[model samples]
Target: MHKVIIKYVLIGVLAATALTSPVRAEAVVPLTVQQFFEVCQPTRVTDFVDDNDYIQFGLCMGVIVGLSSLMDLNCQLDRNDTPNHLKADLSGGNTSLTAYRQTMWNYSNDNPSLRSFPVGMLAASLAEEWPCIEPL
Candidate 1:
């Protein structure tokens, strides 16, 4: 089944832009690769009183869903201001939250760096898929 996936055209996947500076400063690492990893790969606790893996997983996915909705809204405004782009496939087909979640899940497993930056790693995960190429 085809669904809408976030296709990120990270113009500056690594560089902090005018938009990300204030966000990075105000954020106590609101979204980071480390947090994603923790949420996606939470430790199983037998202690019923302390079990919160499901909660964290829900919250993490919720954020991504919210972001996806916002991206969709922005598209209506015809303003692709952010590095985020939405599509179905590598060529922008049917977008799905599972696709983005899976991409983040798979990407974090390999590069286990605790970079507490604003969605920089998120952009990186989709960079190879939707790169902002310049004609030579």
Candidate 2:
């Protein structure tokens, strides 16, 4: 009976050590917007086959508008960079375009409520504006 108890204790200890051992950390590679676009291209192509040109143009315009708004809002929210470091960088132009792309992608994926209404409005507005452009 004592031997059986000792065997179980040893097994538990081994199991605990194995479970707690540090995992090999994954290599972190920072992705660029182009790479992200490429990863998402197939889905975009399939989804917007008919409105590809309009969709692309709208995305570009939306990003520009969103970033401008973010800057304006940040300036009002944080006069000094001390409290909101990321907001300060975003407002100051230290954050790259890739950051904005990543943010949009994250918002679209993580929060449908944040996505749907704005996207619908943007699409409608862009589609209305599309025909006014003279072919280059």
Candidate RMSDs in order: 17.4, 16.9
Tens-digit lDDT track of model 1 for 57-78: 5566676665455544444444
Model 1 is weakest, by summed lDDT over 10 consecutive residues, at 1-10
- Name model 1 segments beyond 4 Å from true: 1-30, 42-51, 80-95, 110-114, 120-136
Model 2, range 1-136, lDDT digits (tens) per residue? 9999999999999988765644312211113333223332223334554444444535554554564455446545545542332232334346554444445455445444443243322222222222122223
Model 2 lDDT-worst window of ten: 126-135
TM-score, predicted candidate 2 vs. hidden true structure: 0.32
Best by TM-score: 1
Best by lDDT: 1
Clashes of 1: 11
